[model samples]
Target: MAHQESSVLQLKQELLRANMDKDELQSQNVDLQRKMEERSQLAAEYKKELTQKEWLIQQLQGKLDESHRKLSEANYQK
Candidate 1:
């Protein structure tokens, strides 16, 4: 009967430790989730900026092509 009581106590202690570990892991998960959300927002902003830059580059390329065409036509007339 004494041995059975000691075993029960040991089981209770193990259960308490497991509960503490679970709480710590849950806290860490929350922190990591918040960081992930922030990183996702930053990435979206960067993608928008990159898209704008690409559009501007395309517009400049169009203007350059137009200038080259006009120059070529003028030289041909000469």
Candidate 2:
């Protein structure tokens, strides 16, 4: 029957549209996952840099303390 054929055609079109939508959503999901990985790597690099800076600051503080101690000793001898 023509009516049955028409119904089948409409159903097929709907199925095709649904498949396209699914493909688009999958692509978007993959993009989001890639961005998340990039951000995670950046965060790790920042953390490493921060740790290095903290170590440098501690080294400088130790040297400053040593200088102050020597200065105090020199003053006491005078």
Candidate 3:
């Protein structure tokens, strides 16, 4: 009877340790998911900003080309 009681106590202690390990793993998983979401949002914002800058660069190049053509025409006429 003493041996049986000792075995039962040992099993209960193992079960408690398993439960604590499971809880810690679940907490870590939640934190990782939250960080992934934040990184995704930041990546989207950066992509949008890059697209806007590209469009502005194109507009500036078009204006520069037009100015160069006008200057050439004036010099040719002189």
| Clash-forming residue pairs, model 1 | none
Q: Distance (Å) between predicted and true CA of 34, model 3?
A: 0.5
TM-score of 3: 0.82
The digit string of per-residue lDDT tens for model 2 on 1-78 reads: 999999999999999999999999999999999999999999999999999999999999999999999999999999
Residue 26 displacement (Å), model 2:
0.8
Question: Rank order by TM-score, top first?
Answer: 1, 3, 2
lDDT of each: 1.00, 1.00, 0.98
Which of 1 and 3 is ahead in TM-score? Answer: 1
Q: What's the lDDT of the predicted structure labeled candidate 1?
A: 1.00
- What TM-score does each of the candidates earn? 0.85, 0.81, 0.82
- Estimate the TM-score for candidate 2: 0.81
Q: lDDT, candidate 3, residue 46?
A: 97
Per-residue alpha-carbon lDDT of candidate 1 for residues 1-78, written as tens digits (9 for 90 to 100): 999999999999999999999999999999999999999999999999999999999999999999999999999999
lDDT measured at residue 67 in model 2 versus the true structure, 0 to 100: 100
Error of 2 at 68 (Å): 2.2
RMSD of 2: 1.7
